[model samples]
Target: MPFAVYVLGLAVFAQGTSEFMLSGLVSSIAADLGVPLSAAGLLTSAFAVGMVIGAPLMALFSRTWPRRRALLFFLAVFVAVHIAGALTPGYGVLLATRFVGAIANAGFWAVALTAAVAMVPDRLKGRATAVVVGGVTIACVVGVPAGAVLGERWGWRAAFWAVAAVSLPAFLAILRSVPGGPRPEAVPAPVSVRDELRVLTGPRLRPTLLTMALVQGATFCAFSYLEPLLTRATGLGAARVPAALALFGAGAFLGVTAAGRYAERWPTAFVTYGMAALALGWSALALTAARPLAVLALIPLLGMLAFGTGTALITRVLALAPGAPTLAGAFSTSAFNLGAAVGPWAGGLALDAGLGHRAPVWVSAVLMASALAVAGVRRADGTVSGVRVT
Candidate 1:
């Protein structure tokens, strides 16, 4: 892989930190901002919602611009929004900042994935995607837990400040490293919106998108509520939450690293077994919520399966949609974010119903099972059957 691909991963690490770090800071944010816990949770969903909306839109708008220019622009917006969020006094303004930051984050992601893939050969695309996605897993391992610690020691806003501070270097690195020009010869850039739309709506790609969405939804439904579950049900102290999160992150890193090896050669079996294992992990977590040791044991295994499967599914999307890299990136980004948005909201609904944190784990198990079903199904031609979005 090119050094520039790693630079793009560095950029993703900075931005992806902001995406997952909020789960750890939710309680502090809720307390400081004088909002209900439920409302503070919306901040996560708000960012996800923006990503779901912004991925394709930002990808389309920036398609004509040089890749370097588009990346820098998005990172600039992301840094600005984080700074604004850190300084905001009102919950509504902070909420708005999360949404804006996500749009910027989504734009960065859509472009970065395309750029990363463009730098490599077709056989290496899966590893390239893993390299980029590995940044996110690394963020979970380092950045998210660090943000939690910052929130615990200073305030929730400190976490936001830290994100902006760390992201600036990534912005500068990307400005220096990524080349400016038309799309590389390895991939063809879309010429028009209609052309991209036609490729996006193709029969082979939609089921991959659906499966990606469901896998992400299942993983995050349990993840978004992990802090609460650990503290309330598993009897862990607040100080231990970051460590637990770190263990999960470590598992995620390992998972992505391991799965990337087989993603290209055995995409179907990788996704199927990964999803089945993840569903079982969630079921086990729900069943053992009261046992601290059991909960800890399961966290990393679950994290491993969750991100491992995610990496494979995304690799599959890139393979299937080679003609439309930018839109393909956008669609994959949108699919995952769509799930990220709904998972938290659905988990919140479980809490609202007085079902407790364990309910969300059960919810995740069900969602993962559905994803397994999708991954397991195939047409007579041995292709994954695609579903139309409309």
Candidate 2:
């Protein structure tokens, strides 16, 4: 792999930390902002809404810009927004900052994936993409947990400040490392909006997009409430929750690594089985929430299965939309955020309805099952390309 690919991963790590750290800080944020817990949860949904809107729109807006330039521009916006988030005096302002920051996050991912894929060989595409996505896993492992600790000690604003501080170096790294040239041959040509829309909306790609939305919806439904679930259902103290979150991150890292090895060769089976495993994991989590040890054991597996499918699902979308890599990548990002938005919102509704912390787990299981069924139907219809396994 090119050194530049890992540099892209670093950028992802910076952005991902900001994206996911909110999960652990929701309670603190709720208390600080004087909002309901469910309202605090909407911070996640707000960020997702930004991503859903920004991914394709920014990708298209920057389609003509050099990849390196686009990346730097977006990273700068990301850093600026983090600073805004750190400094915001009101909950509404904080929410608005999250939305803008996510727009930057979405744009960064859309271009970064294009750039990362361009740096690798055909056979290495899956692994290269995994390496970039691995940054998110690492953030989950290190950044999110550390943010939790920071929020616990210094207030959630400290976590935002930290994310802003870290992003500067990532910006410098991209400036120093990534090339500032025309799109590589491996990258698809910039397509017209109509053409991109056609590719994105084609019959073969629709199911993959739907599956992406459903799977991520399932994952975040449970994940958005993981901290509360741990404390409430599993009897974990605040201090212990970060460690459990780290374990989940470790599982996600492992899942992405494993998926890189097989995603390209067995995209359909990988996605199908991965979603099934996620469903089973969430179902079991719902059943065992009262058992602290069992809950601890299952969290990592849940993270693993969710992210494992994520890597494959991205690869599958790229395959399905070979003519529009940026748009496809953007569309895929949108789908994931669509799920991100829906999951937490749905979970909040469940909580509002007096469903316990365990309710999100059940919601996750149903979503995963729905996603798996979609993948199964797609497979049966032979809509997925028959790429020969190496």
Candidate 3:
């Protein structure tokens, strides 16, 4: 892979950390500012909401800009949001800052990915894309957990401030490292709902979107409450949640790396089985009260199954999309965030219903199984190729 992939990875890591760290420190943030934990928790929701809004909206808006400028501009926005998050005083202000931040986050991904895919040669696109996504996976493994520790030590506000500091360097890395990407030579497409709708309505997109939405969606089911769930299982105090989160992240990293290596060769059948296994794992998490042992043993598998499917599913979509890889890529990311919205909201509802902590995990497990079913129907033998539009 080209060195630009690494720079992309770094920017991803910084953005991802900003996005997820709030989940771990929600209680602290709420207490510090005299708000309810639930209110504080909205930070995560804020980011997801941002992703949902930003994914399609930003994708449309960015069609005309030079890709490098778009990338840098969004990263700067991502950094500035973290600053706003750090410095903003009231709950309402914080919420507004995060919502705006999501806009930038969404745009950064849209443009970065559009650039990342275009920066590479055709044959290497799949692998190159994987390398870039690997940053998000790595962030899952490290960024959230590390941010948790930082929040715990320096305060949640401080954690956001630290991430804000990273933007400066990340921006520079983009200026120096990322290739003079495809924005220059490319003819900008006319942005229209009809254009995007036509892409979604295409034949092969059906199964591809289904596969990602379900499989990826299921992880959030378990992920949303992982901090508390594991804390109960492990019998650890709050301070230890970051370490557990880190372990889960490690599984994500390993799984993503393994996906790039074996997705081409295997039937990818095991990923569904992997989801089944994740369901069973969450079931174990639900059934056992020995929270410490269960979480330590089981949580990482959720990430493993989730990360492993990424390459297989993405390559499948790119193959399915044929001529419209950028739209397909944005759509895939859009689907993931859509799942992101569903996962936490589902978990939160379960928690609010007095269903006990494990309810969300179990429900998500079933969702994963559903995703597996969708994927199981896909003909692995029929490699979906990209469509070329004149």
Candidate 4:
């Protein structure tokens, strides 16, 4: 409900949209740039690699700045990076620009997650985090679809340009509406690096991170190559890809809101059930492409389940490492980007092998199944104190 939370959410929305819209546009970009689609998709990995590297770096460097300034600076970088991505002369240049944008993204999410928790009342932090984090969910629903449509109608370059255009206003919104750095201390700043390691390496932190890797990886594995998957499997045209993306995004939005509302009562089981649902939905999705309508119908349900797990996961981490929530949140964000990086890279291998289109989705189902197993393992221990991670 606070203005800061809303602006934080908008920043996330822009980042999330940029992160995902590429899937819908990859095919077109590949064609435009005279490259393979697999190679085009690799740009996502390049960006993700930037995030993976930038996460800890931002955590280490930005800890000293006023949190609000750190965020605004990143948004400025984000706008610059997207503009570069749009105007680049070659595919390689585009990837480099996106990589820089990805670094900005890492800072945005890291700060946004920590700020959301600090800005809200203790009892409401979970929901507040969800509201802020839901930017990604909304991105899945609106940003991806819209970007894809724009790319299809105009060109993929248009998508990146649009993302850059949005960043200016988002930056202005944060600057005007959010309080600056040296805001209230969320908690006593610990001995920055040492305390961060202690909390991150502590008991609750390890498994929760593992859980995040599995769940987030599984989602990316299926989703990174999703446009090709649907096109190949369902014989859908380029124009329809955005609509399919919209379906998945719609489902995720529902899943996030629903999970956030209920997660406080039974965090572990909620994640457990959500993982189970993801496996089922992914399995169903992989096989249902022959029935395109049915496949499209199921995407939202899949998104709802696959993406909703974050609400409980982040809340759990904050609970376990109350004093060290920022680093924990950073780790989780890194895990998601790591997953994003790996999914497409691995899927590209399978795709390169001349495997049919459904391979990535099928592999994603297996990944989801593995994620479920990991969730069960965490549940069995009952030692998980902080976040659920995935």
> What ranges in model 2 sit over 4 Å off?
26-40, 184-189, 383-390
The 10 consecutive residues of candidate 1 with the worst lDDT sum are 381-390
Per-residue lDDT of model 4, residues 1-390, tens digit only: 688787888888888889878877888889988899879978877778988888777866677677779889889989988888788769888878888888889988887888777877777777777787789888887888789779979999999888888777778888887777573544345445777789887766677777767777777788777888778788889778767877877877777777667777777788888878777887888788778888888877778887788567777776677656457667777877777777766776788888878777777777778876765666566545544433
- Candidate 1 lDDT over 258-348, as tens digits, reads 7777778877778888988988889999999999999999999999999999988888887777678568899999998898878877887
Which residue pairs overlap in candidate 1's backbone? none
Clashing pairs in 3: 141-249, 233-291, 233-292, 234-291, 234-292, 319-384, 322-386, 322-387, 323-387
Q: What value does the lDDT take at residue 235 in candidate 4?
A: 85
The candidates, ranked best first by lDDT, are 1, 2, 4, 3
* Model 3 TM-score relative to the real fold: 0.87
TM-score (all chains, Cα) for each model: 0.92, 0.92, 0.87, 0.89
Candidate 3 lDDT at 299 equals 62
Off by over 4 Å in 4: 27-39, 90-92, 181-189, 235-239, 353-355, 383-390
Backbone clashes for every candidate come to 0, 0, 9, 8
lDDT for position 181 in model 2: 82
Model 4: pairs clashing at backbone N, Cα or C within 3 Å: 212-390, 251-300, 251-304, 252-304, 316-386, 316-387, 317-386, 317-387
